[model samples]
Target: MLGRIAPNLLIRIAGRTTEAGIPPFVDLLRIAELSGNLPATDPSSTPAALLTRFPHLAEVTFEDVVVPGPHGPVRARTYRPPHPNGIGLVWVHGGAFIGGDLDRADAHWPSLEFAHRGIRVVSLDYRHAVRGVHYPVPSDDVLAGWRWAASHARELGVAPGALHLGGSSIGGNLAAGVAKRLRDSRPGTDTIPAGLVLVTPFLHPFGAPWPTGMLERMRAATTNAVVSPEDLTHMAWNYAGRRSVLDDPYAFPANGDLTGLPPTLVITEEIDTIRTSGEDFAERLRAADVPAVVRMTPGAAHSSMSRPAEPTAQVTLDAVAEHLLGRWSPRAA
Candidate 1:
């Protein structure tokens, strides 16, 4: 028994074991294998398949629009609420930089929820890092989509300067990049979004050290079992394409200047590795004198907000709706 247990002890000593807090519903989803591997070649991972899987989209009122980008035209879906609050949200979907689309379940569910709450949501089907496309391609597409949303706010019936930007996972990183570009651009060139909502955002592709206790627990969590450190490194390479680009603020929002960013809300998962980075990003925003708040959903894993049935997920979505409606208070629970 000692011989058999010695290797296990050694593995733990090597810090290869983590204690992720996986909820029952998430466990039933069996996301471990799916998260561990990139779905670049999987047909089911395509955007079309995502839309087909979620057939209730017709229940909501939405329109598909084409936005012009540097490389080409990018498609985006706009969901309208029956009672408009005059606020708009530009959402981007996550796929580890290589997969995912506007129709992604994670993006769809939240968009519908927000739209129903009276905030118009524009989900961008930005370019991904596939077929030789990488880095700036996706980021540029997101920027174009944002500009279109802002410029056409009048026609869309959304109030100017009331538009908000957001994304999940890598999508969060792209949204942050777009916000930064808007802030850095010539004054009055574009309308800056009133706020940002980052859900379990992948902000630090280059890596950041987590606090000791948090790191140990995050590593031990089963919720993180699907994604290994190697997988993250691989995804980063796919997005950046070159090592030099890794340092680019657009590629890693954590490295960018956080000053002048609009009021921001960063939502993180308690058991996810990216939580540390997301929290740190929020801290940076505060340090830069930007109004920022960070909230963690206990017992939640990466992308848990996509689950509409989960109470914590509902809380997360409600928080987002509040933020978009300009009612989010940093001191509120």
Candidate 2:
């Protein structure tokens, strides 16, 4: 009976012990199943609810779509701009591979922002690696949504070859895996995404090694920034459901060859323990001759993208929007 852990709940409760006598821990997925007052994952919000939170999005058209996933019908939310930019993004939200949904801030806030920037965004409500679901299922849902968007680009107003794939945290791992799968499956086809965006992603099974003295520096900054290596391994193993899946390139892109992957942008939180994983992946992509860029959000923690009202969060997303727009029209941006 693993209780649902809300996004960023670990950070909120950091250093606070439960009445059950369990030691204070910062890992959300490893929390003990408690009976009362436990935080729950948010349900998908209606358009009215969304607008109440973001009145500026009143002009942005939102549509709820049902895409055919291999497992079954996958629900998705589409954000349409009042003015189209001919660019589109199929985005995934993060929750350490277990918690989160379309209502999560990481999903809808960024989707609304990208749409406001004139890039049509389709945010997927992919299955989580919980309740007996494991690797390949969530990635498969994203693949199905991508294919659906690519096939209907004309009606969707997204230019051919202008669509990008991206995600944050575990969602980033799934997006990258699906990108690799597309490249391998199509070989020479143009069905792959034109680019990829990974924000504070957890790429490796045990997380990447921190720079010399970096761990000390991060701890001094904030305890909330520290995600232990054991926790990373636990999350990965939980998502995999078996040791062998950890070695599967498609399951964790850090273990795979990234030679032919699309241009990539890896955004990291300055004080987060998982920052190195995203940074290391960027270096690996560059070593493989792929165009990869890494940007660190100043004074931020992991999952900061979920707080849209925060200045640091605004700065991070503005950078993401700039990258997408610049890639499409360099002269205009």
Candidate 3:
């Protein structure tokens, strides 16, 4: 085992690579050199470092805000565009409920790119499910962030009707829960998001059945990075603080009604173990008559969003931007 290396150590390793003008791909390779337990050529490179190498483009800028939360003030960053398109996103980043920050690649790059293209993004820094924090805490924080954004949409330069809620990985699970809570608790039309964007999400504790032989083919492949169903079950149990809470629909949206949810776009990585969870949840949404579209970035592994320099990550990011801009048509169910 590599043992638990301080995150700062990994950050330093990635930071040195970034300063040397090394490609993002090599940053993780250096980290993986520590042990075989770590995947060689993995997407685990800290995106916060790699992305800083690029020059800032356009007139996009960001502001830090303190939003009121159930526990206390929640930290958030808002990315603003020179021109507003009336679309805004309340974004969440993923770390399996225990880690991740606003600067993570999933949250930062997308917010910057979307803002450059004329959409505003409010990225949340919610409480993680660590140090006795559990379900409904992180959920409550996201709900609080959404409420703040919705109530101040005009001042935030976003149309109330066009504000969206979205997240990736475990963050997606949190976003889905917030959407469900708003649907059930608030009856007003303006409370819900215009649509949902879920990427490489883990929706089910035990994922839907894999496409026939898909699991076998993936395992046979040489990739050292893979997240299995058992891995997801462990994450769910940790977030819930107990096995029973997994049944809580708000904790895991797959356990609740899929009807009446907003139109959604679910993006998956081709070789990820969690791919089926997103795909299956989208189909369930469609079966419930909610408009849902699912797409897979070919040859992508999990955490593709973390490597923005890669062509596959670019495709994934474009899919989300297109969905928000209404520029791309959803694939037929």
Candidate 4:
């Protein structure tokens, strides 16, 4: 329908002309304005904001509980399906290993979509590196969530073997770390997730800490300075922690071999800085015959899944649900 309208339709519908040299994003802005219930500017402490913003959505219920983490106790919210569940996603929220709780902008969609598709998603409020918590704390907490989900599978209406783990951005990175830990901890069983969903994850944070440019700009936007580029570099190292940081897969998942991980789905925004890393992990995992499928969205930017309703984020979740529900009947990719 959008393509049917002339470009001048903006002026007709929005009362604003896309005059000379304007980026294509004007239409998106107009659409968001019309929709009006998209994520609020502040999402961390305000998730009912989305509930009020998009009331058309249904078939989801949120339950809060305390689950045991490797370090200690952690908070988690389980997104339940209206129907029974066949698959569950133990999801970690993205905040660059620093910030973000389950109520943040990104964790909102998977809860609804996964539930609607009859898939359960346990969104973990993992201990972050900020506020003196770090590395294994977050990863271990997610692994613990998986164990809890598996143990309570019958209660959650899922089969024992259908649970999966995934996350976006740093969440994806932590999910990868959890995968390695699950494999190492549980041998000779499918206790690990049936598959993995990595969305523009930060898998290679060691020898390469974002190539010293745009990512640095993003980092700076989120953190104030010491004012030197090297300070930013050291900040990453310190966040990962100096001792045994390399061992933490969130900082460097490439160190671990991806040989028998699981069937995998990867989503990357076109302009996301982590796009290359996500695709790289996909290629490596597929080479090992890990059943990896990667989707590189056209015209989507970094953290596309977090804010606004972009086709890339929407379609990626659609494919994930289909694959999990065994309804992936689309023409072969």
TM-score of every prediction relative to native: 0.80, 0.85, 0.83, 0.75
**Which scores greater on lDDT, model 1 or model 4?**
1
In each prediction, how many residue pairs overlap at the backbone (N, C-alpha, C within less than 3 A)?
A: 9, 0, 0, 0
TM-score quality measure for candidate 4: 0.75
> Which 10 successive residues of model 2 have the least lDDT summed?
32-41
Error of 1 at 159 (Å): 1.2
lDDT (10s digit) by residue, model 2, range 1-333: 233554455435444543322223323443422321224333334334557767887778788899998999988998899999899999998877766777778888889878988999989878777667888888899889888888878788999889999998888898899899998895655388988999998888888997787766776775454665666787788888898999999889999799989999888999788999999999999889888888899988786777665568888898889899985432221
Which pairs clash (backbone N, Cα, C closer than 3 Å) in model 2? none
Which residue pairs overlap in candidate 1's backbone?
Answer: 18-219, 18-220, 18-221, 19-219, 19-220, 19-221, 20-220, 20-221, 20-222
Better of 2 and 3 by lDDT: 2
Cα lDDT of model 1 by residue, 176-195, tens digit: 98899889999989889888
Give stretches of model 1 more than 4 Å off. Answer: 1-59, 212-216, 219-226, 331-333
Q: What are the per-residue Cα lDDT tens digits for candidate 3 across 55-81? A: 553367888899998799998999898
Instruction: Give the Å shift of residue 96 in candidate 2.
Output: 0.7
Model 3 clash pairs? none
Q: What are the runs in model 2 whose C-alpha is more than 4 Å off? A: 1-54, 188-190, 223-225, 327-333
Q: Which is the better candidate, 2 or 3, if ranked by TM-score?
A: 2
Best by TM-score: 2
After superposition of all CA atoms, the RMSD between model 1 and the true structure is: 8.5
Q: Compared with the true structure, what per-residue lDDT tens digits does model 4 show for residues 82-134?
A: 77557777888776565567777677666676777778778887876654565
